[model samples]
Target chain A: MARKLLLEHAQVPGINTYEVYRKHGGYRSVEKALKTMSPDEVVDEVKKSGLRGRGGAGFPTGMKWSFLAKPEGVPRYLVCNADESEPGTFKDRYLMEKIPHLLVEGMITSSYALGANTSYIYIRGEYSWILFILEKAIAEAYANGWLGKNIQGSGYDLDLYVNIGGGAYICGEETALIESLEGKRGNPRIKPPFPAVKGLWQCPTVVNNVETIAAVVPIVNDGGEEYAKIGIGKSTGTKLISASGNINKPGVYEIEMNISVEEFIYSDEWCGGIKNGKKLKACVPGGSSVPILPHFLVCKTANGDTRMMTYESLADGGFATGSMLGSGGFIVYDEDQCIVRNTWNFARFYAHESCGQCSPCREGTGWMEKVLHRLEHGGGKMSDIDLLVDVAKKIEGNTICPLGDAAAWPVSAAIRHFREEFEWHVNDPKAAMERNYGLVNEKVNA
Target chain B: MPKVTIDGQTIEVAEGTTILNAARQIGGELVPPAMCYYSTLKGSGGKCRTCLVRVTKGSEKDPRPMPKLVASCQTMVMDGMEVASKSDPSVVDARAAVTEFLLINHPLDCPICDQAGECHLQDLAFEHGKSNTRYEFERRTFEKIDIGPYIKLHMTRCIMCFRCVFTAQQLCPERVHGIIHRGDHAEISTFIEKSIDSEFSGNVIDVCPVGALTDRTFRFKSRVWFLNPMDAHRDCPTCSGKAVVWMYGGEIYRVTARKDKYGEVHDFICNTCRFHTKEKGSWTIEGPRDLDRHSVISQNHYEHGEKTVR
Candidate 1:
């Protein structure tokens, strides 16, 4: 029974409708923000809330908002990144589908804070049903005077539109999403002129995640200080964790960031304690891109402290013995699943989704995917393991976008924590082909 | 002017000069290699990681180093910035990795390719690449596609540098072809197979870093090592008409834009000058192109001493 902000009304029936959402105190932030507070006051309150972007990067949202350049006579934009294409991350989709008005309300308030005349929600193309839901919600808001020209007589004008993406994972990246919105190919632009300075047809722009913008509603309604008191430290406020993979209750759960990782995975209210009483082998605490943690380090840190679900606690060991709370894609792995095969699957996704702008990502992603495929399919050599690490290292810091690092991390982490598993595949090809390498008993090379 | 130190050599450049340009101003071995960055073409660079350099110190105001290696071709030179190109072992390793990535799927058909003697990729492979490749997967291949009567699009040889796309948008009036699909499957395609018939369309062949785009008229004509390149120009209404005429036995084999020491074409020649007007008597010769003594074209031809080639 933790505090739920974004998803408090998620389970309410008819929450998708404007009237139903209005009766339940929806869009209160819009009224409070536009009526009482000035635009800069809203930004100040958000900064006080200590809210961070729920996207994989975990950058501070208020800090990101402050970086938006305010050049006179030049229009600034606030784009909602509804393109939730990351694997095992479906909380945004769930939030939008269950309570679409929450996002629309967030868009209106966030846009007012940023002084944007027009805003956009660039949603994933695969979520066509949710797109329809969001579009309907936006239309409902415009009809009720919550959106568009002189909202509730505040004299602050705003118009919000929903744009659908072409179902590519790279479009989730801010610059690539901007490129796709501009009716062009989804190649990521090189940064120096970041999106905050020159974005969206050469104007200042701020792209916030769906959950990040929606959370702004609560930050506005409850006041930043009230919201800041919920979660622990800098990880203030409740976060939506999209739990999946070998969990009995594998659904999106809203938890305050103060809970321990053991409580989250084993509690009856949360994941319902890994499916069928099976032994948990590992976990990718964040999304697929973050490092994977073995069973020994999942519930506790390498320093033998209780691992909380906060950002600092999850990343306590910094990729060697710790992982990130990235996008909150808490995926659990049972003993039966093989790390090598899973790593290869993620590699294939990255290779397929890469925009092919730069050389390392364009070629190296596919190269790693092919090498991992050979290893998984019983045609690997022991030397292939080190070669994969070398290639992944080369691609980590050398691309036009983070997609290169995203593609490289899973491969490197798999081999880093589970080298014996990879070597097992290389050493015993026939046995590896027949069945997966079951759970390692004693952490052979960890 | 900004004073930026690259590889321990400090130089002052103009207000908005890039790190790559600053290094080029102090030209020598430290000037990073560029495959996609054509100086004259707007919005061309940063797509090729070949020119990546480490900024050890960001600027005089912000002394913090950049978190990652940045593309030097696009990064502006901040005052008191310290950059490491060939001087750092890490930069060298990154360049070698980039070179390897660029060559994994490249059809190593330099023996038959027409851009061999002066290819930027050839020089890069010689300098930064390993002797043998580690890629065991089947190399990507594509059928030769002729974009028009003059330019052949050899998609397999492309490194996705985007130089030709920038060239088409900037130099040519209408751009018909661009990169289609994504990732490793991406190719330079005309989509519905439309012929690029613009007057300045032939310049795409020159801006291409590899043999991806070549003069269709000169396909398989001869290896470039045998033909001596001579600087020549003609007075024409459409363009500057300054070009290099590749000649063998007193006959023009192929015509191309005259590239600078960095292999960038500043004066873009038109199709009429490049494809249609190829004769020994069409223009005044400006002597054998001052071949870099280190260039592969100058290997055997300069043995008779640079004076006999013309």
Candidate 2:
């Protein structure tokens, strides 16, 4: 069994309640961090853990925490990014819904480490029921004296609030989330004055993913070195993979980083293989933003190395034959799936979610969607496929946010790996509209 | 001052000067077309990707070439930096692609449009647009709305440059208008259909680069090419009182805020100077030489004397 850190106690009956969570060794990290360690010490421990952010970017959590500018008389903030709206990713929602107290405990420890007197959980508005669950857990924490004035009599005061967003997918971006929290439109702010220097009412702030902050609990419980020893290479510590799509047992699973991709896919303990014994056609190992990998590439790298479920291994061949472990949104596709239709669906999502700030993303995403829609529905010319690639290439790096690149990658990768399929569609529009490309029944390495 | 090289021209600018402003200072054809950046607005760049430039060498501190093309309006120039705009084939292709994107859904009703002669989109499309677009899908359309008593909004023509939203937020005290919805359907909307009846609402009409926001008062007044702009001013307590009067056959058609060589309004003129001070008797009209070089009447109708309108 993969070493589970976050979901070890996920099956505990009353884990959502503070009393039950406390009985099962909750808030121990808070006590250890507040009483025994200084803020710098806590930060140093996180740095030593080698824990990269679980958010799509994979920035170093400790380095990001250290970058918070502590100016005189300015209140710093620790904002928990609970706006998990990335397509095919629902681990944060599952964690908050099942074990709400874990997040609360993690926030407390992280806020103390960052010297934050006030904190916020900027959750997506669609998660109203999860908001209630989080709020109830927060109330329970307050009642138990884990939050509020002088927590654990350590002379540190912290106040955590749950702010509901107007439900924008762009709000998942830290700057956009801060803008939304500030009662403004969720347009991404320009960087160079990153959130560390000026954010959330122009105060020094640290915006962290919910999983990144929650991992602080384990880093504090065990030493950073101990936590670092579990995962392979730079991707240390257990990660929550939100498995979906054609997988049989589709849900969130916490796996240590050392597991091989083949075992994780075929083993009964994890995704339990493809649904209805269908062969795996492709896999988006990370979230939808990362490139999709064909069945052969997903199991092994281009150099014939067995692909491990770690950041370094997954991104071995860059965007050519490898994909990133982005937010660990593992989506599997059976042979019956249509890559063109799936690409169109993602393009539509990006076009619908763009804040219309930058032209490349705002305009390019819509163009990709229109062209893909034409191709999928049988009105496409052969030149339209090249145009889709052209438009996607134009949008890749020209936008103000990563959303532009996210909208570009899937289309580019699909064209890279499956150009023949797209050509088939354009060559015979009538038959393409009537039926999908169907399953590729070739043997595994054929 | 930091010295930067742009298209073989080396110039020293202030430490935080952007490449767009630097190129604009060099003037003539070197000026990159910027659709979203208004010199008067504090935060009005980076939205429109029309100002992309390739930096061959990053700066003195980081000599590596930047990984990607940057928005010239947003990126500040550093010492020993090498930048390329119109001269670079990649930048030209990028600008052309952006121009295509801008015109994808635009209702090309230029004949009846009030801003045809002065429209930035029209000028850019002429400069960088392809003869035909590959996009054969349905264009996005929105119903024309009278957002305010003075401004008419045709949302379909809006490229989402966000200049109007920034103008309303910065100039209007009661900012009731903003972008609503998401993605391709995203549009500028007032809160709950409320009228954008702010004191500075008419300025949005001037700041808008497209015909999305047109002056309702001057909707069918006259083509901008036929109207002569005369420098005019008034001694009003509300604004700087300096403006330009658009005249046709000795009748004052409309009054708009005066702009410097850079096309930024010299002062945020009030509703009176913008809408009410339209009479020729309200202010002194300067000679025709004071009109901007880009103004349609400046290059087209130079034969017409000031007395021709008087």
On lDDT, the leading prediction is 1
lDDT of 1 by residue, A329-436 (tens): 999999878889999999999999999899999999999999999999999999999999999999998998899998998889989999999999999876776666
DockQ for each numbered candidate: 0.88, 0.71
- Minimum summed lDDT over a 10-residue window in model 1 chain A is located at A437-446
Which pairs clash inside model 2? none
TM-score of each: 0.97, 0.95
DockQ of 1: 0.88
- Evaluated at residue A44, the lDDT of candidate 2 is 94
Candidate 1: stretches off by over 4 Å: A437-446, B299-310
Model 2, range A1-446, lDDT digits (tens) per residue? 66778988999998888888889899999999999999999999999999999988889899999999999899999999999999999999999999999999999999999999999999999998999999999999999899999998999999999999988899999999999999887989987679999999999989999999889999999989999998887999999999999988999999999999999999999999999999999998888888999888989999999999999999999999999999999999998788888888888888888888888788789889889998898877889889988999888888888999999999999888888889988897766655564323332235
Model 2: lDDT equals 0.88
